[model samples]
Target: MDTDAYTTMRFERRGQILTVFFRDPAEANTSDLAIHEEVGRLFHDLREEREARAIVLTGSGPAFFTGLKDPVGSLLWQREQGLPVIDAGRQVARRIVWDLLDVEIPLVAALNGDATGLGATIALFCDAIFMADTATVADPHVRIGVVAGDGGAAIWPMVMGPALAKRYLLTGDPVTASEAAHLGLVTHVCPVGEVLPAATAFARRLAAGAPLAVRYTKMAVNRLLKDTMAGAIEQGLAHELLTFTSEDMVEALTAARDGRTPAFHGR
Candidate 1:
């Protein structure tokens, strides 16, 4: 597959198995606007690749993928452009997460390290998720004064149950790899160095399976997820965007930038 157009991810094909690595390893695969846009678009390219039967999703360096890169920078850019960037971001999420769910082929996630916010949401969409023993998973949207609209509200309750999903989403707490496995949030957990190998092996097994059967099965099973996403995506995204302009959100962002605790007054 020709992946030269992907600026935020590295794509490699090994026979019928494709592995996509999030870029900027040195920065812990922190995503910015360009990366978010790429996430919204990459699946179209993947769908066109007839040779790829399965996919492995992962990030490099110490983290699987952090939430956002330079929140303050993004806020400033939004201010300068007179646009609600947060709303724009949620729209991208709606497109990308839905596209990921619609992918007919099996997909695996190799969580090399911590995955937060959008990263966690993406990981949860995979057919199977394998994490490094030392890694963690979280959707810290509430921590930044936003709703978990990306795929959190749509997928988490299905995978982890509504109570656990509500707890984590409400508190913005991190789930350790072992904890995730215990809670059935991940397919497998291995040592940090073994994550990629295990994920690749799993992907290859799926690639070697009955291709049409695998594709059709994935399509059938994802119906629930698709319905859930469709039902909640619009309202959740709208509410999340509303939070972006709240006094609490501004205070939270400022506190994050200053490395201090924010005092949210529910303004």
Candidate 2:
């Protein structure tokens, strides 16, 4: 695959197995606006990747993916500049999930470290997730004063069921690798430093499988996810956009910046 167009992510191909790394290790591979846009386009472009039969996605450093880069600051800046933050965010968020679902090849996630918010959602969307024993995952959009609308609301319930999904989503609590494994959230949990190797091995196995069978099977299974997303994504993102302009969101951002607890008054 020609991966020179991507900057936030690096790609390595070994035969038919491709490993894609989140490149900004110093920042824990947090997705900024550029990263978000690039990721969506990357997945969209992968539809034409005839060489790679399976892909392994992992981070370069101590995080699989953290979330957004300075989301609070970015939101504040957009508001101050009178930008149409909601429409812009809605477009990016929708494209990421849709493009990811459209990929025909299997996607395996190697959670090398903590994955929070949108990071957790992306991992959950994968065909299989291999997480480090020391790692944790959580969709904490609610904690940051927004709904878990960016594929989180749709995928979490499907992976862990509604009750268990609500427990995490409602509280924004992190689930340890062991806990996630027990709950059937992650496919495998490896010891520290082994996550990538384990995921790569699995992806190689997938790559060696009957290509048409594997691809078609994945397509069949993903139909359920697509249906759920079709139902929930629009409303979830719309609600999240509304929360961006909420008083509670502003207070949450301000309190986080000030190193204090936010006093939300349900505005």
Candidate 3:
């Protein structure tokens, strides 16, 4: 695709797989308006391409993704573009998380490095993930003063037990890639720079399998989780939506920008 138009992501094709990459090396591939739009467009392309059998999602420069777009920067964009802050964030989430998860083809996360908040959630949408052994992953949404609106809310407990899930989800703690592989959150922990190649190997294996059998198997498995997750996705996303307009969200962003602690008064 023509990457000239996007400032935050790039779309590339490798054999039968579609690669959607997050850009923003200076900020650890942080989420932003441009990345969100490109993610949606990439998925749409994958859905439209009959020959594409899988997706390899990765970060362009490094560090997977830091997290959500800067709320302060986003608010500025909201005013500059004459848009509502709530609507803009929601739109970004819908494209990056909700829309991305709806992809039917096998999805793979190539963790170039650490992933956090929306970054980690993006990886969670994938059917499989391969991470650099040295990389780490974390939810950290709660620490940022918002609930996770991405697939993490629904699938986290399924990967790890509900007990551990609550611990990590509530605390916004970081977990290493090796630990994640051991806990079933990721499939493999590759050498520091082998994440993309490993993911490609796995996807190529799936691509080599009988298409019908693979698709049916994936559908059955995901359907089972869909039943188990139940209302997790909706409830978590609702929590995030309600938080955006709150004084706490403002306080949280200020704390992030100012390099200080936040004391939310439940407003």
Among these predicted structures, which one has the highest lDDT?
2
Clashing pairs in 1: none
lDDT of 3: 0.73
Give the alpha carbon lDDT tens digit for every residue of 141-191 in model 1.
888787888878877888888998899989999999999999888999999
* Residue-by-residue lDDT tens digits, candidate 3, 1-267: 354556566677778777777775466354565555565566555554566577787887658876445656764444445436666666666555544545567888999888877778778767898899888899877775777766677778878888988889988888997689888888888997788888888888887778778777877776776667648876776777776666776777778789999998987
Ranking by lDDT: 2, 1, 3
| Every model's TM-score | 0.93, 0.95, 0.85
The segments of candidate 1 whose C-alpha lies over 4 angstroms from its true place after superposition are 25-31
Estimate the lDDT of model 1.
0.82
Q: Give candidates' CA RMSD values in order.
A: 2.0, 1.8, 3.1
Off-target runs (Cα >4 Å) in candidate 2 are 25-31
| lDDT of candidates 1 onward, in order | 0.82, 0.85, 0.73
Q: For each predicted model, how many residue pairs clash, with residues at least 3 apart or on different chains?
A: 0, 0, 0
